[model samples]
Target: MKGPHRIIIVGGGFGGLRAALELVKRRARLKSFEVTLVDRETRHIYSPLLYEVCTGGLDADMGRASVQELKSGVAVPFSDFERRVKKSRLHFVRGELTGLDEEAKEIALKDGRTLPYDDLILACGGAPNTFGIPGVEEHAFFLKWLPDALRIRARIAAFLEARRKGKERRVCVLIAGGGPTGTESAAELANFFQRMTDAGVLDREAWHVRLVEAGPTVLPNHPEPVRQAARKRLEALGVDVMTGTKLNKIEPGRACLTIADDGEECIREADVVVWAGGIKPPAAWKSLKLPVDAKGWLMAEPSLQLKGKDHVWGLGDAVSFMHPKTGVRVPALAQVATREAAIVAENVTRLLERRPAITWNPPEYWMTVTPLGGHHAIADLGRFVLTGFPGYVARKVADLMYFCSILPWRQALRLWAKGTMVYMRND
Candidate 1:
C-alpha cells in the first residue's frame, strides 16, 4: 500500500560510506527501504595519503593533471561503487546540505532541492579550525581536500625551481601544530628536500623545516614512549621542533609567535606556512537545531542516535560521544568512526524490524600506525609498539584491510596496488 521507506545519509566520509556499504550488504533482508547517500564531493578522497600528494610523491607539476584526471590514484568516485550496488536500493546524490526540518522530515540543499526521508543518518564531518587567526585563511595552506594538497605541491615545486635558478637562498617551511598530520607532513617534506639536495637539483645554502606546537610536546595525545620515538625520528631528519610555542599571527612568508617559558615575542620567516592546526564541526550542523554539546558537536545517546531524536543518528567527527568508562570524549579517528559505523548500521536494521537497538561499546584499544618519513613509522598496538620498516609494513597492511572492507576484492586490490606503487617509490 505504501512505497518503500526512505533512508537518507548525509556525508560520504569514512563513517557514512561504511554505513551505506553495510546496508547494501543486507539488501536482501532489508528490502522494505531504499538508501540514498548525499555528499558535496563526487569522489571519496583517501585523506590519510594527502601528505604524500603534497610532498611531490604523486607529481612534480600538479597543474598538468587535473583533479579529475588524478582521481584514480588517490580517490574513488562514487560511481565506481555501482558495480557492487547494481540492482540494490542504494543511490548517491551530489548536494551540499543547507538546512533541515525535523518536523517535516525534509533536508534542504544549497541548490534549492529538498529530500524527504523516513530515517536520517548525519555523518557530516569537520572543517579546518583556524582559531580566528588573522591572515591564516589567505596565506597558510591546508591539506584537508584534494585541491589543498595540490596547491601545497605547486608551492613546493615553485620554491624548488626558484632555488635551482638562483632566485631563492633557502627552503624555509613552517608547519603549525604538532599532531599526526603536522608531524607526518614535516617528515615527508624533509625527505623530499633531502633527495633534491642530494641530487644537486637545487642550489641552497641550507634548508629548514620547522614544526611548531602550542602544546608541551608533539603528538600530545600519544603515549610517552611514542612521543619520545617520534621526537627521535624528527631530530634525525633535522626538523626544528619547537614546542610550548604559540602562533599569534601569520603573514605572507612570516609568522609571529611567543615562547612559553620566557613570554617573549618571536618572529620566524617562512617560504610557506602549512596549517595543520585542527578542525571543528561544520557550521551547517548548528543550523539544523539538533541537540549539540557545548563545543557545538552533535550529542548522541549510547546507541549512537541523536539525543531527543529517535529517528536520527550521528557518527564520526560530527558527533560528541563520551566513553562510558573513562567519561572522556572519543578522539576523532578514522578507525573509531569506521567501528561506530557498524554499530549504527546494526541499530538501524534493528529499528526497521521493531527490535530494541543495542548500546554502543567500543574496544578499549585500537591500533594506530603513523608513518614518519621514508620507510619508517610508529605503530602503537596497545601494550606493544613497533617502529622503523616493520611499522611501515603494518601501516600498509592496515590500509589494505580498510580498502578491502569498502570495495570489491578486485577493485580494492587494484586501488591498493596503485597507491603502493606511487607511494613506495619515495622510500
Candidate 2:
C-alpha cells in the first residue's frame, strides 16, 4: 500500500520471461512497480528447437558458429535477463520454488528462504508425465530441458560410438509417444543415425527407430490431412509408425507393448528409449494451499488471478481453464503461454493502479509448425497447410519473428543464421 509495488514472478519459462520483459518495456511509464523473476535455472531454453539439440543437430558446424553454440544460440542466459531488466528495476533470482505461503503473501524456496511479495505471478511450466509407465522413469530420456537434450545426445552418441567400434551389434531406438515431440525426435534420430551410416560409422541395417502411440494415430489434435501427410513423410523417412500401440512397460534394454491390431503382447529390444508422451503441472503445485483443479493445475479467474485472491496470478501450464466451446481443458503451449504472459502483464499493472482487470480469451488461431527433420517441416495454419520447403521457411520466419520480439535484433538475426547452418549440415 506504500511505495512501489513488489512483484515476484515465479518460473522463467516463456510466460514468466515475457511477463518480466513486458514490465521492463514499460518500467519508465510505470514507476510504481518492482519486479523479480524467480526460477531454478538461468537459461531460458527455446523449447521448440530443443529436439534439434537432443538429436545432436546442434553439435555440427554452423558457418561461423558451432552447433554447440547454436544449441544455446536460441537460449538466453540469465545475465541477458539482467541486461534487459536492469534499467527497469527488475531482478532475477535463481532458486527452486518449493511452495507458497499465500496466507502471508510469500513464496518459499528450497534453501530455507522466502520472498514476500505484494503481487505474485506463477508460470512454473509443466513437467513431463509418463502416465505411470514403469521403468520409463529410469530408462527413457526426456527432452524438456537443456540437460534433458544433452543427456539424450550423449546417449545417442555413445550408442553410435559403441556400434562403430563393433562392441554393440545392433541398436533399436524406441520412442514412446506419437505427439509432435515424439514424431520429430523419431525423424531426427533416423536422420542423425543415417548420417552416421553415410560416414561409415553405422551399418544401414544395424539400427531401427520405432514410434509407438497409444492414440489412434500421431498428431491426434491436428487435422486428418496434416496427420496423413506427416505420417507419410515419417514412413518415407524410415521411421516405423505404430499407431494404437500402447507402451505397457519399459525395462532395461527392452519395452513391453500391446499391439492394438492383433491384441497380442510383444517385446521390442531397444538400446535407447525416449518418452515424450505428456506433461503435468509441477509437483510443488500440488502441495501449495492455493485453489487447484482436480489434476492440480491452479485455478484462476478469467483475469488470470487466483479465483478469490487478486494478489496472486496464474498462467502458462500451471493454470487451468474450461474451454467455452468444447467444455474441456486445454494443454499448455508456448504460444498460449506467451499470450497469457501479455495478459498477466496488463492485468498486474492494472491491479497496481486499482484498475479493473482484463480477461484472457483463448486464441482462435495458432500456427503449429512441426519440423520433420533434415530441412523439411509441416505448418498447420488452420484453414489449410503448408508442406515441404515452404513449411520449413515459414517456421524459420516465425522463429525469427519470435526471437526479434523477445531479444535484440542482432541476437535474433544471429540466431536465425545459426539455426539455419546447424540444421542444414545434413546437406
Candidate 3:
C-alpha cells in the first residue's frame, strides 16, 4: 500500500499477456504501478494455429520451411510488447515459478530468486492431461508447446521420408481424444497427407490417420450441428473416426484401445501418436495451497479474484469459474481467457482506486471456430453456426482481430498476412 504498487503476472499465456497489456493501456488513469509479466518462455505462442504448424500447413512455399521459420509465424517475443508500449512500467521476466509465499506476498522461482508483489495474478496455463494412462507420459507426443509441435512435424516427416525410400511400407498416425485440438489435428493432418500424395511425394494408400475419442462423439461438448459438421469433414478427409473408443494404453509404435459397446480390446500399429486428450492445471499450484476445484484448478470468483484472496487473481486454464447464469464452468478457450483478462484488469484498477470491483459476465457473441482442413471450418456463434469456406474465413478474420487487440495494426497485419499465406498452402 506504500510507494508504487507492484503488480506481477505469473504467466505469458492468453490471460497474462492480455492483462499486462490492458494494465499498461490504463497507465494514464492508474498513474503509479509497475506491471511485471513473468513466464518460463520468452515468447507467447499463438496456440490455435499449432496444429497447422505441425502438419506443415504453415511451412514456407514449396513446403521447405525450417522449424525456426514455422516458429516465426506463431511465437511472439515478450520483448516485442516492451517496444510497443514505450515508457510504460511493463517488465518481462523469464523464470519458472517453483513456490509462493502468500503471507509475504512474494513468488519464488527455480533460479533462487523471489519477486515481491502487492498484487499477483496467476495465469499459468494447464498441461495436457494424460488421465493416468499407462505409457502415455513416456511414449505419447503432446501438442501443447511449439517444441512439441515441431517434434511431431519432424517425426511425421521422417516417417514419410522413410516411405519414399522404401524403408517403410506404411505410416500411421493415431490421435487421442476428440476435443477441438484432436479433431483439428486429425483433419489437418489428413489433408497434409493428401497434398503430398497428390504431388507424388507419397502414396495415397501408404499412410493412415485415425482419431480415437473416449466420449460418445467427437466435439462432444459442442452443439449437435458443430459435431456433425466436424465429423463429416473428418470422414471426408479419410480420417478414421472411432467414437466411443477409449485408449487403454500406449507403447512405442502401437496403441491399445477398447470399443465401448463390445469391450473388444484391440491393438493398432501407429508410427506416430499425438495426444490432444485434455488439460489440467499445472501441479505447481498445489504447493501454493490456494483454493481449488475438485479437478485441482484454482477457483476464482465472479470478480476474477482467487477465492478469499482479493489481492490475488487467477485466469486462463489454470482457474475454474462457473457461469453465473448457465451454471456450467466456462470452457478454457482463448476468447474466454482474454475476456476474463479484460475484466481482471478492470477489477485490479478498481481495487487500486478503492472502488468496488465489477463481475465478469460472459458475452453473447462468444464464438468457437475449429479448422477442418484445407480452407474448411466450423464456427459456432451461439444461436447460429457457419460451416465450410465461410467458417474458415471467419476463423482467419478472428485470428487477425486477436492480433490487432495485442499489437500495432501494421505488425498485426504483417503477422496475419504471413499466417494466411502459409496456412492456405494446404488448401
Candidate 4:
C-alpha cells in the first residue's frame, strides 16, 4: 500500500533491536523500504543481567548510592541507537504503541498518533505478568527495566538502613517465580547482604533471601540435573529454596503463600518482595484481537511470520515460537530472540523482493548460567555442568557476546568491562 515500502517494528528490546540493526544493513539493497523502530522508552535495557545492576551498582560518589548508577550501568540510551540507526535508513521513534489496524496497515500511539506501514513487526517484548494475584500489582518489586531495578535496589538499601537503625535482626527478601530471574535475584541479594555485613556497613545478622516457585522445582525448563545443581548451590548460599510454593497474595511488606510440601498457607513478613515470576505480551498486542496461544502469546508460523498473515510478524517473548525441531516449545531467552531477529530480517528482505521466507531453524544448543553472587556460578550446557569460577567466567563471556552482537566492538568491550568494574577492584 505505498510509495516507499515501510516496515514499522514495535519495541526496542533484543528482538526489535536485532531486527532493526540487520534491517538497516539489508535495506541498502531494498532501496524502497523505509524502517522505523519504536519503543515507549528512550533507552534499551540489558534485561537478562538486570540482577547485576541491583547488586553490583554501588556508588560511593553519591549519597545513599545513586539510583542513576543503575541507569548508567544497564541502559543503552537512544543516543547509542541513533549513531547506528540514523547512519542507515532505519528510524527510531520514542512512543508507546497504543493500537494496530491490520486491515489498513496502520498503528496508533498513546498520543493519538497513527502510523501506516506496508509491513509490521510486533517485537514489543513482554511485561511482568502478575497472574492476577491479589495485591501483587500494588506491593511487588519487578526487575523488568533499569528503573524497576533501581527502585528495587533503592528499596533494598533503604530497608537495610532502616533495619540497621532499628536494630532488626533479619531482613526477609522474597522473590516470587523461581525461574532464572528469581533465582539470580535471590543469589545476588543474598551475596550483597552478606558482603555489606562483612564490610561493617551494617550490623546485619542475615537477609533471609527466599526463592518461591509455583512449580515443583526452580528452572523447570532446564534439564533436571541443572535444576538440581542450581538448587543445591542456592541452598548452600543460604537461600531458602521454596519450591512448589505459590504466592497467593502480597500484602504491604508481607506475602502469603501456599506451601505444597505441607499443603498449608503461611504468611512471610519481608522487608522487600520482588516479583520475578514471568512475562506477558503488552496490552497493545492483546488489543489487536489476534489469535494467540493458550497462554495468550501470539502464535507464529515456522518461518517466524504471524499465522495467516504475510506482512505482520510476531517475535521474542511476545509470541510462542514452535521450533520445527524441538516440538512445540521455545524459550524467550535473548539468544533465541536475537536469532529470530536475523531470520525475520532476512525473510522481511526476501518477502519485499518477492522471495519465499525461509523456515525458522530452531537453535541447536541450549546454555545458561546462574551466578550465586560475586564470581561464583553454576552453568548448564545440555548434559554438561560446571560449578564455580569456570561457570562464572562462562557467564561473563556470554554476557560479553551479547553486547558484542548488538554494539560495535570497542563499545562492547567498554560496556562489558565497565559493568563489572566495581567488583574487580572491590570498590
Runs in model 3 with CA error above 4 Å? 57-65
lDDT digits (tens) for residues 59-133 of candidate 1: 344455533334556788887775567665788899998988889998999999999998899998888999998
Q: Write the per-residue lDDT of candidate 3 for residues 197-264, one digit (tens) a residue.
A: 88877778888999999989999889898999899999999999999999999998899999999999
- What is candidate 2's TM-score against the reference? 0.94
| Residue 230, candidate 2: alpha-carbon lDDT | 92
**Which candidate number maximizes lDDT?**
3
- 10 residues in a row with least lDDT, candidate 1: 58-67
- Model 4 C-alpha lDDT per residue in residues 125-151, reported as the tens digit of each score: 788999899988888888888778778
Can you tell me which runs of candidate 4 are displaced by over 4 Å? 1-3, 58-66, 85-88, 163-169, 203-206, 423-427
> All candidates: CA RMSD in angstroms?
1.7, 2.3, 1.8, 2.3
**TM values, all candidates:** 0.96, 0.94, 0.96, 0.93
**Which of the two, 3 or 4, has more lDDT?**
3
Full-model lDDT, candidate 2 = 0.81
lDDT of 2 by residue, 1-427 (tens): 5767788999888899899888777675567778888988887878888777765542353232444565665588867768765555778898988977777888889998888898899998888998888998889998788888778877776666676587878889998889989998988888777776778767788889999999898998788888999999889878889999989898889999998888999999877898889887778776776788888888988888988776888888888976656666655778888888888888887766778988887854566999987778899998889998899888888889988978889988987787666656652
C-alpha lDDT of residue 342 in model 3: 89
Cα-lDDT of candidate 4? 0.79
Number of colliding residue pairs in model 2 = 1
